[model samples]
Target: MAMFRIFLGAVFAAIAIYTIITGTSHGWNLVPVFFGDMAAMNWPGQFNFDFFTFLLLSGLWLAWRHHFTPAGLLLGIIGVFGGMLFLSAYLLVASIRAKGDIAEIMLGRARASAIGKQ
Candidate 1:
């Protein structure tokens, strides 16, 4: 758990720093470039599509973890758009909140508690 927390922390920091640098240089207009790459159908486009799928999966999982409540749905959208910047921070907080319980981290509090009761 300690190691997991450290890993999440490192991911959050690294991605955050990288994002800042990239955004500063690129002017933060990522949508066109991202979608344009996909339209181009090249290696960068292929990679972007793959990464987009992963982000979509991440968003769906987050929504499912929260049982798709309004807040969960909102978080799902944010997860897709915010990408690792949102996810790393979210996982770090969830890990602490779950007290290192992997099941709780994945399943959320209510679901994890219900599973335990069974």
Candidate 2:
């Protein structure tokens, strides 16, 4: 599990980096285009909304799991703006930190819920 996490994380981080580099070609003008895409009111618009919903969930999870720390907030913002590229990599790191302990990974940094067990 640890190895898988590391491997997947590396892949995601690399992909995200590549995406960032590629996106630079578009410059900042896409900010308005982003809103326009969301406002299209067609299948593509629906898809955009679907992705936004996922982004919201990702941000919520990050904030919830990281004890609402600054790092958590920052990552949440990144997840919102950077999308799955940031999220997959973040999950990879978290999974690696869990170190094959499913409970720790699922429960975030607080394993109190799994304490006092055999």
Candidate 3:
């Protein structure tokens, strides 16, 4: 689980970095590709790069701690799960076209609902 957390943290950090870099350079054109076209058309300015920076840093911190307080755990789970879902939905067609292992890939989703128990 720790390894999984670390891997997820790294992925999110890389993504946040990419979003910041490319968005600053190209006015967030990368967002539509990274997220979705609908999101690109209606992105919330409140949930911009700074928000992602906080999210990415929080994920990294929680992963390094090995465990979290209930709220932190919830955040970690949402970060992992939401990230996976968003990525999966966006890539489903591509994966199907490439004949990839969909089930294996989907196991990446760390359900946020599990955090409700905490």
Best by lDDT: 1
Ranked candidates (TM-score, high to low) = 1, 2, 3
Per-model TM against the reference: 0.97, 0.74, 0.30
Candidate 2 residue spans exceeding 4 A from truth: 2-14, 17-25, 112-118
Q: Which pairs clash (backbone N, Cα, C closer than 3 Å) in model 2?
A: none
Local distance difference test, per candidate?
0.95, 0.74, 0.50
Cα displacement (Å) at residue 48, model 1: 0.4
Q: What is the lDDT of candidate 1?
A: 0.95
How far out, in Å, is residue 48 in model 3?
22
For model 3, the superposed segments whose C-alpha errors exceed 4 Å read: 29-118
Q: By TM-score, how accurate is candidate 1?
A: 0.97
Give the higher-lDDT candidate: 1 or 2.
Answer: 1
Question: What's the CA RMSD of model 3 in angstroms?
Answer: 12.7
Question: After TM-score superposition, what is the CA distance of residue 82 in candidate 2 from its true location, in Å?
Answer: 2.0
lDDT digits (tens) for residues 1-24 of candidate 1 = 998889889998999999999999
The TM-score, computed over Cα atoms with residue i paired to residue i, of candidate 2 is 0.74
